[model samples]
Target: MRSLMCLLFLVIFCSVQMTSSANLAIEVANSNCCGVFSNKKIPVNKVVSYYKTSSICARRAIVFKTIAGREFCINPETSWVRSHVDIVDKRTATPP
Candidate 1:
């Protein structure tokens, strides 16, 4: 019984750690930029089209991952990113 309790505790702790790590990564990605930029732009719906923590320090940027597994920092102020964000927001918003 004691061993089983220890195992359960370990599992819970690991799960919490993983969740926090992912959250931290997202926060960092939203606030930072990547070290390099990709030559091609990825659509927002792509599989790799998600924000991630930038591996490098950049100013006013968020790391973007393309469907092709490429990573780069893009300026959120750009019309492209802004427009996509709007679209996503609209799609995800609760319907009246």
Candidate 2:
């Protein structure tokens, strides 16, 4: 019983740490120039505020790539591209 309790505590602690780390990464990501939907031009300052006000976290480092003269959110961990809603989209056109 004692070992089970210890294991439970360890799991909870690790989970919280992972969640907070992800949140921090999201905070950094939202501070960037790209918008969440991949189409809007949001102010950097506003983006910074967005992350601070929310508890949601991004699982990976967020990236902004300009492909074909358009902006996109590239989540490196999952290799997802916001513009195409696909895990990986080859740059169809030259980046601007």
Candidate 3:
């Protein structure tokens, strides 16, 4: 009876650990935060699309996805970054 209780406890502990890890993974995957910004200037024409980082992020930034399937995080306040975001937005905007 004691051994059975121990085995049940072990199973319950493992289940809790697995549940916590899965929750953490899901949170990380859902977070669209950028830890750092890239200083490299990506040509506006090369950017196929762009998106702003989530408000929950520590820093305000823009993410630009290039035609070559690469993503760059840039400071939203930068002049070039703002212009690039504007251009990309217009390009992707749906017709009224």
Candidate 4:
């Protein structure tokens, strides 16, 4: 009975630790703003390079790297960026 109680306590401690770790990871990911594209706007087609998510920022911005190597953040809700994203997704989904 003592051994069972110890095991239960261990299990509860591990679960709480996991939950805390997961939340910490999420908060860290959402706290850092993208240095390359903090506040700028540009056309989607002009984006020579781009990334899809908050991997580069605190929010869900479409980070675009222009031909000049200048980075800009564009809202993902814009029609231009959304349509281009759809096209890219469709293209990549096709079998070569």
Better-scoring candidate (TM-score), 1 or 2: 1
Off by over 4 Å in 1: 1-33, 47-57, 65-71
Off by over 4 Å in 3: 1-29
TM-score of model 2 vs. true structure: 0.33
**Residues 1-96, candidate 3, lDDT per residue (tens digit)?**
999999999999999999999987787689788999999999988999888887767898899999999999999888887778778778888999
Candidate 2 lDDT (Cα, whole model)? Answer: 0.45
lDDT of 1 by residue, 1-96 (tens): 999999999999999999989987777766545555555555777624445444445455656655578666666666687766566567567899
RMSD (CA, Å), each prediction = 10.0, 11.9, 4.4, 5.5
Instruction: Give the better candidate number (1 or 4) by TM-score.
Output: 4
- Assess each prediction's global lDDT (C-alpha) against the native: 0.65, 0.45, 0.88, 0.67
Judged by lDDT, which candidate is best? Answer: 3
* Residues 7-63 of candidate 4: C-alpha lDDT, one tens digit per residue: 999999999999999997887776635544354446555556666664534567776
lDDT of 2 by residue, 1-96 (tens): 999999999999999999989977877676544335444443332221111112243333344343334344534334222433232233233466
Show the colliding residue pairs in model 4.
Answer: none
Candidate 2 residue runs with Cα over 4 Å from true position:
33-96
Q: What is the lDDT of residue 84 in candidate 4?
A: 60
Distance (Å) between predicted and true CA of 41, model 3?
Answer: 0.9
**Model 2: ten consecutive residues of lowest lDDT:** 45-54
Clash-forming residue pairs, model 2: none
- How many steric clashes between backbone atoms does each model show? 0, 0, 0, 0
Q: Candidate 2: deviation at residue 33, Å?
A: 8.6
